[model samples]
Target: MIPVAEALERILSALIPAPAETVSLPEGWGRVLARPVLARVTQPPADVSAMDGYALRAADAAAGARLRVIGSAPAGHPFAGAVGLGEAVRIFTGGAVPPGADSILLQEDATAGDGLVTPTEAAQKGRHIRRAGLDFAAGDAVLEAGRRLSARDIGLAAAANHPWLHVHRRPRIGVLATGDEIALPGDPIPPGGIVSSNAHALAALVRASGGEPVVLPIATDDRDAIAAAAEAAARCDLLLTTGGASVGEHDLVQSALAPQGFSLDFWKIAMRPGKPLIWGDLRGTPMLGLPGNPVSALVCAVIFLIPALRRLSGLPAGPVETRTALLGRDMPANDRRQDYVRAELARAADGTLTATPLAVQDSSMLAALARAGALVVRPPHAPAAPAGCSIEIVDLSSLGV
Candidate 1:
């Protein structure tokens, strides 16, 4: 069996990023940029007022000084006349500062009368004025390639005059769940069969990773059935299969697809609850085979599939992030395989996180996995750790798992 990190490295190296496509600004949110977005126009195209006040020559506006009132300029309207000596123009916020106006006398600090205004407080030159290109200049790269656009990024792109953006197409993933003992929810079940949950759960994980999921029908534990179902998903960017990946008599994913052009890269990673993982290619499509158990399937997906999706979607690809936390309880020494212990996380009064392993970590118990907040990572052959010992953890809540 290969180590988990080596398996992941092999999978990512075999894939490529999705192609680029054009999308409107409204649809660009949450999409990764394929190219940089340059500013089409300068922000604050010209010098403008940052506050509602009077625009005038700074030297003429001393305390108690009076100046002749010129025409007013509101936002989107430029004062046609320039401010001469002892002259002021009434301006509102966002109004272009008229020529020869080097200062702004705040309205609250000035008294106005018929055709004239007096400064109660002296005006400072260049104060309350937004200079041209204050935010960004034309031709500047406002957004770089490969960045996932957020709401704030959308607004910045819009302000930079981008009506449309070039972004990488969302990766299309085909999810296939297999097993003779599993049936769809709400369908009449076969004797002793359980409802299929792996497909839907993995689909949600794909969406969360910014990929589009195409859920294929469940393939029974038959060679012809598995081969046909996999062949049907050859056009997808990636094909994810659950179940029939182990060594049992019913596990036929490797043998069944061998005759149909499936090439094996590696199998059986050194990890707990998910040792029966499979990574290979079916025809021309990349395929990942997860374990049959729901908890195991989801956990493996979080570690492997999420990073694969990121690489396909043109984002910087790497393992899911982890952080250090104090152990809330004692744990025994680990053996050969790497372990991911499901645990609950809480913040102590000192604002430090403490992770406590759940009582039951059975791979088939989806309820226990749902209640878990994190997965405390235990390396192979590591010594036992006691309460308050520092440990690395994959935060499930942060990953939205």
Candidate 2:
């Protein structure tokens, strides 16, 4: 079996980013930008008030000085007249400063009545004034390409006068679960069959990673059935098959798809709970085959499929992020195969994280996987580590898994 990293490399190297499409600014959130968003107009178009205050010349607004009130300028309205010699304009937040105004006297610091205003404090030049282009200038690239747009990005784009944005199309991932002994949830299960959960779980993972999931019908453990189901998903950016990957009498994914132009890149990987993973290509579409066990499939997907989705979605693609944590218990030396131990993560009073492996880590125990907060990573042949040892862990909650 090859190493896990090699298998992931092979899968990502075979894929390309999805094509770009034009979408409205409202639709751009969570989508990867395909082109930079340049500012069409300068922010704060002109000198404007940063707060509600009186706009006037600094020299005329000394402490206790009185000034004539010329007019009022609220947001979206610009003062037409200039403030000359001992004159002030009533201004609110975002109101453009009138011509000849060099400072603002906050209303709280000024008393206004009888068409005149008195300053309780001295006014300083350029104080409380939002200068033109303070936030951004016209023609500036406000957002860069390849960035996943967020709410803040959308607001910035709107301020930059962008009504539409160019973004990569969300990758369409087709998920197929094959097993004669598995039935869909709420469906009639065979005498010894169990309910299927891999497809739905993987679909949620796809959505969380910013891809669209298309769950295909469950294919039974037969060569024709598997081949036909896979053929139908050739149009998808990537096809995922769960079950029928290991070397069992009924494991027919490789043998069945071989006749249908499925090119085998690699079969097993040196990893615990997921040694039977498969990465390959079906005709022109990339294909990833995961183990039948629920926990194994999800763990493998987190390691391999998430990166593939990111690549296809035009985002920086790499391994899922990991952070350091202290081990809460002793761990034995690992073998040649890499290990991802499900564990509970707790924060100490000192703000450090401690990861403790779960007592029962069976691949079929989905409940145990749900209760796990993190996965303590154990590299191949890693020496035994004691409690309080610094270790690397993948935080499941952070990934929305």
Candidate 3:
């Protein structure tokens, strides 16, 4: 048996990022940046007004003094005339601040008349004027390579004059569930039969990890049938299979993979609910074989499969978002394996996050998984944690749940 970390490293190294693709800004969210995006044009290309106010010379403005108004300016329109000493121009939000004007007196503080204005207070320098290149300068590296596009990122790119974006191509992942006793939903359950749910669960996992999942049909526990499915899955950039990985006599996933030029990277690990894990490569496509237990498969997918997908897409997965939370009840540590305890996060009156583990923790309870906000990460060496004890919480919802 190999250690989990070593197997993870091997699987990650075997996968590489796909080629870059040009996509529209609307469709680029969560996609990694393929090129260093520079500011093609400076935001607020010139000095502009941030609010509706009077643009005037800051040094000359005095409280309660009425001054002549030069012209009017609104958003997307610039004043044709400049402001002279003791003169102010009527300006609205997003309008260009006229040349030689250093500050603006908010409309509430000033009174307006025909070509005349009055200030309620002395206008201060650098007030309400957004200076040219304040947000970004021309040629400035506004976004670095590998930055994942978000909604705000799209806005920034637009501000920087990017009409389109170049982002890393999403890796195509194949999801398969193997076993003879498994049946799809809506199918009549035979004696000792269970539903084949691993594929759908894995598809959601693939989406959460920023990859596209191509779900394959259930591959029954037969050497030839499993081999044919494995060969087809190898066409994608990565393959993920659940079940048929243990030492059981009928487990044929290992044997089927051997004929397809795939080598075993690992077999078992010191882990609870997931001792039959397998890792390898198939025809240049990396594959991760997870236990059929619902919770175990999901946890392994997040821990191992997700990071592998990140590497395959050239994304920096080291910065996964995690927060602190207090345990709602006492918990025990594992004997020799790590454990991920799913829990719902509730904010306390004092602004603390509390992780309350659900009572129904059976791996088959999908509803409980859906209600969880995050997983409380505990290593094998963790001591018993009492109620209100703080622990590291991995944000599952942030992972695109």
Candidate 4:
């Protein structure tokens, strides 16, 4: 058995980023860039107006001096005429700066009558003109390599005239649930039988980590059936198996994996509720064995599956959103292994996020998970935290695949 962080490190080292491919910007969200994105065109393109005003030389705007108005310029339209001395052009927001114009006086600061303009106050040079390439210059590496694409990042790329982006593809995941005691939900349950929920929880975990999950049917305790399912699961980028990871009499995942060339990386994690975690490679595919408990399966998936998905996407780690918040209540004493306590967050009048831990954290309780938005990480052998203690929190919203 090993610590969760150490186990995660070992699991991630097995997989490598394959390569990058060109895809449309619309489909680039959640993917990491393989190479830096260079800007093809300057943003703003040219000097443009920032407001509805008149453009003229600043020195010509003398007190109470009226100037003849030239042609007008609006967004996407250019003024063919130039502004001569003591002359101004009617310009709206986003309009191009007319020729021989050195400043822009807002309409509020100026009076217009009879096709002429008069300034009431002094204006400075380059007041409201958005300079060319103000946001990004052509040929500049606007987006660096290994950067994850978000909705706003896509907009920035589009502003630079990038229609297609080179990004790492999403990882494909295969889920296998093993056990004879667990009955299918729709199947009839005979004495001492329960419905299968571990695989369903793991499938949601895979999607939360930004990977595609394909759930396979239940693999009974029989060695032949487990072996057959493991063999079929090798084609996916990752495979997650629930149950049969312990060394109990009916456990067959280890023995079945040996024949299929799966080098056992680790078989256990030194953590609460999820001790029987198995990680390795089967025919070059990354595979993980999670404990049968629903919460344990979900926790292991967050620790291991998240990182694996990130590595597959060419990122240093799978994209999990994190934030710093204060603990609002005292927590239980932690064991040698780390603990991720589910907590409900509250924003105080002082603008501080206070995380109050949920009282119930059993390995089988899915009801507790449904109401929590963040998890408070407690390190191994850590003492209880009093109220108003700051800690790191992994937010639920950032888990996009």
Q: Residues 261-379, candidate 2: write the lDDT tens digits.
A: 99888889999889998888898988999999999999999999989999999998988999999999999999999999999999989999999999888999899999999999999
Worst 10-residue lDDT window for candidate 4 reads: 392-401
Pick out the ten consecutive residues of candidate 1 with the lowest summed lDDT. Answer: 392-401
**Model 4 TM-score relative to the real fold:** 0.90
- What TM-score would every model get versus the actual structure? 0.98, 0.98, 0.90, 0.90
In model 4, the number of clashes is: 1
**Against the hidden true structure, what lDDT does model 4 obtain?**
0.83
Q: What is the lDDT of candidate 3?
A: 0.82
Q: In candidate 4, which residue ranges exceed 4 Å CA deviation?
A: 184-187, 318-333, 342-347, 351-360, 372-376, 383-401
What's the lDDT for all of these models? 0.94, 0.94, 0.82, 0.83
Model 1 residue pairs with clashes: none
TM-score of 2: 0.98
lDDT of 4 by residue, 1-401 (tens): 68877787787778887467899989988788989899999888889999999999888987677989988998989999888998999999989998899899999998899998989887679899998888889999999988888899899899889999998767778899998888878888757878898887777777766677889989999988998988777678888899998889988888987887888888877777688989888888888888887777876777677878778878787425568999878876788887878778787899988888888888788777767777788878888778888888876545631
lDDT of 1 by residue, 153-220 (tens): 99999999999999999999999999999999999899999999999999999998899999999999
